[model samples]
Target: MAGVGTVRSIISDSLGRSVMAEQPPKIVILTAPGEGLPDGLEALSGEAELLVAENGAQLRAALPGAQVLCVTDFRTNAISEAWSAADSLQWIHATSAGVDALLTAEVRESSIPVTNARGIFDRCIAEYVLGQIIAFCKDFAENQRLQQRHEWHHRETEPVTGRTVLVVGAGSIGRQIAQICGAMGMAVDGIGRGARPGDNDFGAIYAQADLISVLSDYDFVVIAAPLTPDTEGLFGAAEFQAMASSARLINIGRGPIVRTADLVSALQDGEIDGAALDVFEQEPLPAQHPLWDLPNVAISAHMAGDFIGWKRALSEQFITNYRRWAAGDALNNLVDKTHGFVPSTTNR
Candidate 1:
């Protein structure tokens, strides 16, 4: 990665918070090289000093001088390495939607507020989930195989209109998914920590305690919940056993939310008909992994929520909140560190 030098100016963007402070704040951006953030960030260079760090060493060095940290690489544990050095950091913003990797004890206990790019990825992930549902119901995997073999084989595909779906999370992303699935005529059921009457998106809501009993009733099970103490290992052998044999599982949440071995075993035993896994316990899912060989599984490289220009969207969102933060107004998409996600109350 190339080193980026900072250029300071005194001009602040008019869009920034209306409030004025005595001095320009120092902001550090932790990002990989060659990625595009919004172009207009330079306009704020006058209001705040901007520093870019692409790796842990640089991040640690930059942390000592910054009041705000923009973490473009959520997977990096550099925050922990530089926590002691972040004497001036008052706020931390993560570009990625999930903050599981950033929820270390040090960050959790820090007085600094943490926020994430949440709603930006909601629609992208919802569309991906819908696509997976259709693919599984239509048996697109077999269709592709037949195409490769040049075999004129004919098979009956299932209709998704009357099928049922269990959305295991009621956050913005899950609600968006439920809305889409419901509109398409699939019965949408949601499970949340505190289940209540659903809106147009969710056809019905179920408490976590009712999950196992209803597992066998749905044809698709989707995991979109954040990784929290209560939701970790939420799906295991028992849950898999409770699912109908024809049900397909789609996981887009944190990898640790679902147990890998149990999922693979369920597939092997024909406990579930298929799976479309966009996340796993281990990312880049080792090349030798057995899931790759499964005929009934669809695998993606953790890109369900990534669309064209998504990075820029994340950056722009940060900039909007940056303006609000600089003005001392309420920030958007603030996270409740204890739950490892933006609290549902905030989203509503």
Candidate 2:
């Protein structure tokens, strides 16, 4: 509950301590109002200089002397400006689970170390995926629609128990989904870049090549993979056609990973039963978009992993990494420039 001035003083003190020890590094926060900083950072109050920017002008002004910039929104081009304006800037931390939006060509080419909120949204997103799957399986949407019409309808519903779920990209979030799904008695299958014996925590594991062959067997398919060169346009007409006519797909990963046009065609043709998508190729999904009117498709405003405590979770991750950095230790969750993140080598 510290005031803004108190937070500013704490930041100044932290920076002063670093400067006196010949390692001064200014910190700038790029987040919307009401997003609380981590508890650990309260101790840094009076130790580092902190500046909060809400708009382009304020953001640019705050960047001139910053050494680290923490970004919460990727909508602005201010990131590039900040990099150009601050010669001392060496690290960039994204407060979201995915860093795709902030991975601009300029930022990627720079030597600055970049990290993301990798593990923060795992449980939250898993629960969301689970809810969607159960809702779809139980025909909750249809029941709700009937209720609004004042029609009494009762029907037997399918259980998730013993059903199969195929999860693409067994990362932290994907593994969490698998675990929760398994707890509900659903068989879980995961596909990733490399499939080693006894490597996955999910019920079953397969390599990327097995995706098309196994598409027809699952009751639910969840795409939680990162957007990389190999994953762009990975799910298109052919993959959709390969799925069972009764299967549904859920995407909580990068938007472009699933082709919009192909998905539209599949939904129109009834190629697949339904879809619950939280991400899209174009955000705010234009008003004219056909996906909104599709009967079997459920579209969300990219908020599946966004929850009340998300900001605090993100800030806590930064604080933990900051402590490591201050102690002269290697940063955790380092992005692999070659592959976004090294799957096999890094600990999830």
Candidate 3:
């Protein structure tokens, strides 16, 4: 098949030993026009036949013989509708950490393995979380609000050095977040799908089911868990009510995990003091959404994990995996598709 060819290459250098030629594999780079493959990715030229697909028509046309699908435009769902044409697809790589959008019914029915850009965003996102924590503790939002009025209103700010933080995810990003928080002298506890003792940077680990009992213990409620059946709408009225009224919420995970309406009401009713939401249940949050009007809320356009050259990093990660795939080795950052996140390394 055109997309399933074996890679063939010659080895010549220091030792100068000759080997049989290897054929290149076929790879389809599925992305929007401007979001094409990153620079330096062309280095694969000698080892693979690369196809670029910019639309449903283009993707469907390329799928028949393409062995690897690289979803560079993570927002598109053309792959699901075009799956039937991907007769030779052996693996899929999503540039985004979240693969839920790419794993459609057709994809779920197929056996092709899926990989993602996982580690690339961990440090950046953890740093973003720390910034949010500091901003909230320092009352930066209120300071800005007061400044807009040209009035000097001085106030005392709470110190975060010994405050408690509850990170509701134990994946790589969560661990990084814990380490930073712990280093700054904050008490950090992590909650995971299957929680256990003695996890790094965490004072303790709590199971998902224990969120209610644990909600009141932390000054910051940080959601960094993946979107899954068990975690969807994980924080609702009951959970919010259990939290201390002075506690602030930070969500860097999928938006649906915190019920929007419930969160709004919680904030409105002073169930929680404030919130810093990076991701929302809806993208490009509607113009009239109540969250925007709230005084204590700080919102971002979902760029917490985005750092300069992130696209290139994603490309490099995929290329590293490509080498593994071509050599028949186990892939890295293998998402637990059945669970919607990477299982802890210990679990793996």
List model 2 lDDT by residue over 1-348, tens digit each.
321112122223544652222334568877655554543456555556767776566677888757678778755566665556666666788777667656778778889888878877888899999999999989898987899999998789998899899999888888899889989999998998866456446766788988898899998999999887888899999999999999999999989999999999998898999999999988889999999988788888888888887766667788777666656577777776656652445433
User: Alpha carbon lDDT of residue 158, candidate 2?
Assistant: 91
- lDDT for 228 in candidate 2 is 78
- Backbone clash pairs for candidate 1 read none
Q: Largest lDDT belongs to which candidate? A: 3
User: Native-vs-model 3 lDDT?
Assistant: 0.86
Which residue pairs show collisions in model 3? 6-23, 7-22, 7-23, 8-22, 8-23, 9-22
CA RMSD of each candidate after superposition: 6.4, 5.7, 5.5
Question: Which residue runs does candidate 1 get wrong by more than 4 Å?
Answer: 1-22, 32-40, 346-348
Which structure is stronger by TM-score: 2 or 3? 3
| Candidate 3 ranges beyond 4 A from true positions | 1-23
Per-residue alpha-carbon lDDT of candidate 1 for residues 1-348, written as tens digits (9 for 90 to 100): 111122233545588645533556889888765543345567677778888887778878888768888888867777777777888777889888788767889889988889999899999899999999999988899999999999999879999899999999988889999988888899998988876783667877788888999999999999999887888899999999999999999998878889999999999999999899998888889999999999999999999998988866776788899888876778899999988888776423
TM per candidate comes to 0.89, 0.85, 0.90
lDDT of 3 at 17: 79
Q: Relative to the unseen true structure, what is the C-alpha lDDT of residue 209 in candidate 3, on a scale of 0 to 100?
A: 84
